[model samples]
Target: MRTVREANRWAAVTGALLLVALASSGCVALLVGGAAAAGAGTVAYVRGELQSTLDAPFDRAWTATVRALGDLGMPVTAQEKDGLSGRITARAAGDRKVTVQLRKVSGTATEVRIRVGTWGDEGASRQILEQIQHRL
Candidate 1:
């Protein structure tokens, strides 16, 4: 009887230790996951592709995108639009290419993505996106 009691107590202690180990590992996983997400956002910001969702219809957003390009003096080299989506490609001085993509998210919402140059110029892309938002 005494030995059985000792064995039961040992088993309970071992189970508790296992649970604690699992809980601590979960915390580590959460920290790593959060760091990964932050790193991805930083990389995107550094890459110079600016994205925004605007409260505007697709046609209106498309028009604003074109106007923004022109306002920045980036001549539109190519453009196409349909009921659901549109894209405008342009070139600025120094042959920097700019692309603006507009996607209809809903009847009154659009997602705009802008990238400047092949390697992406953060300042230029941000300026263009802000211009489009202002026009919208």
Candidate 2:
């Protein structure tokens, strides 16, 4: 039989390998970053957008997003909200188009996706997400 120490070592190695695999696959990013609070969820910068799921209601998330834009000096160009989803379009520095979309996942969870410009701005997107998380 394997000793307790040997079993623990094996488990650690397995966990490390799993993490490495996930990281290389771009899945680990989804499980990392952000604060330890309830709504301090992880964020991922994929394609041309930054995405995150906050443990807050849709209304709250929407409000925080708007506030975040204001805090970042982004001017709102258009906005719409409904029972299940919301979208806010803004203009950032250099007149870059910034879009934030929110979808209701549950009563206490909402998914937020942000895109800056036609392509993407990872730094600006991250700042917006951080601001939203702060407000949440």
Candidate 3:
């Protein structure tokens, strides 16, 4: 009977040691995760120059502008080209209507042709197009 009791105590001690090892490994993994997140944050803040306007084609430039606008909380549903210029129409997240044009000119961008209104502005549209003109 005494031998059986001794064996049971040994088993309990083994289980306790395994738990401690697992807990230690968990703490080390958390430390590694924190370090990786900090590294990514540092890399994203690096400054860089935009490509020269002459280096980009009109189709690519217009596509990039539309994508940029989408990233800024606007979603483009339709885009069309007529001659060298093109038009882009997007609805903000709240379904606000916004329209902007792109002139294939290099060096600098030009003004916005129109702004129908903000989302559900009761038939009123604001001129946010001028500010985001570069963003297509």
Candidate 4:
């Protein structure tokens, strides 16, 4: 029974109210999605890669990353490191390429990102991350 303009106004008000309610309740993640809502240590699929933050110093995490590559029988083809970040590129089974990146988050925290194959093989990436975590 309401006119189009009136109905549109009502809809806008309803949306604004919903946003305010979600913000106040700290449930705004319903709008953000994925790891933003899941908290740290949660493996997230992002940009065709799997990522997770780790609780370890950069130096230690870097070492574990190298060890993990060996433990998984992946041959490290190349590696590069700087004070703030590093990357390890390896060849996995079936000649699939894997790349692991370590970024310093704090003195004792690092963010790890792994991608397997060109587009990304989620299962392989997750397994590689788990192996690195285990080594850590």
Candidate 5:
């Protein structure tokens, strides 16, 4: 019984320290779950990026993202794409860097991630995502 108590205490301390380390490293996560079931999307914000699973194919999603950037008047600095993944780098107003990454999740789903600036601007990221979704 004493040994068991000691092990439990050590585990609790280790878990708390891990959480503290992650928090101090500027790693934060917010999960907005259950949207997929409602035919919308599943979204998460983590580590200065907004991630979402869109109900669209990778090709369609990639096209929508490119068009969205153009529609928003953010000049595309760079774009790279293959069959499985794609990335778009753009310059927002004031030259703030924006990045959009996409991966093929399934035949009917694509994963999208967006980050604005260095640390991240959640509002701006969300707006970009909304624009992409609008095109999709």
Candidate 6:
């Protein structure tokens, strides 16, 4: 396990680097960063942080994410699609056109993979999924 001091130091360094990257490249850098973080999934969340949050029941995490995103602006969209597993989708009420998706992970009905986007919700589904996965 990483010590508190070590974690704090790394966080500070990360924050500084991120600020520079964002200032130079805009929020896409942040999206990429978040996706990178979320990519670790159930493994080491980072170099040392254990990803215990993802261990919760899929519904619990999905609910929490929906709530969190709702609080942030996105609201649930579609609940189902023909010939496919059910999906929990949402969108922002604002002009930005942000859409969010929570789909069941393969071979499981209880777990979900989340994705978000905008502009009629077309194309770039993977980026949305990566965005949610990286952030969470």
The clash count of every prediction, one per candidate, is: 0, 0, 3, 0, 0, 4
Model 2 regions more than 4 Å off = 1-40
| Alpha-carbon TM-score of each model against the true structure | 0.66, 0.71, 0.38, 0.75, 0.72, 0.34
Per-residue lDDT of 69-125 in model 3, one digit per residue for the tens? 666667787889864678888876557666656555543332223344442232222
* Candidate 4: regions farther than 4 A off: 1-40
Clashing pairs for model 3 are 96-119, 116-125, 117-125
RMSD of each: 8.2, 4.8, 17.1, 6.9, 6.2, 13.6
TM-score ranking from best candidate downward: 4, 5, 2, 1, 3, 6
At residue 22, give the lDDT of candidate 1: 68
Error of 5 at 80 (Å): 0.9
Q: lDDT by residue for model 2 over 90-123, one digit each (tens)?
A: 9999999999999998899898999999999999
Residue ranges of candidate 5 with Cα displaced over 4 Å: 1-40
Q: Distance from true position, residue 118, model 4, in Å?
A: 0.2
Q: Encode model 1's per-residue lDDT on 22-124: one tens digit a residue.
A: 6787965556654653331222244567766777888988998899889999999998888899889999889988888888878877877788888787888
Model 5, span 15-89: residue lDDT tens: 999888767775533111443433438777889999898999999999999999999999999999999999999
Report the lDDT tens digits of candidate 4 across residue range 1-136: 4698899999999999999999998778655754452344766787889988887889999999999989999999999999999999999999999999999988877889999999999988988888888998
Q: What is the C-alpha lDDT of each candidate?
A: 0.79, 0.88, 0.51, 0.87, 0.88, 0.47
Model 6: lDDT of residue 77: 57
Model 1: C-alpha RMSD to truth?
A: 8.2
How much lDDT does candidate 5 score? 0.88
lDDT of 6: 0.47
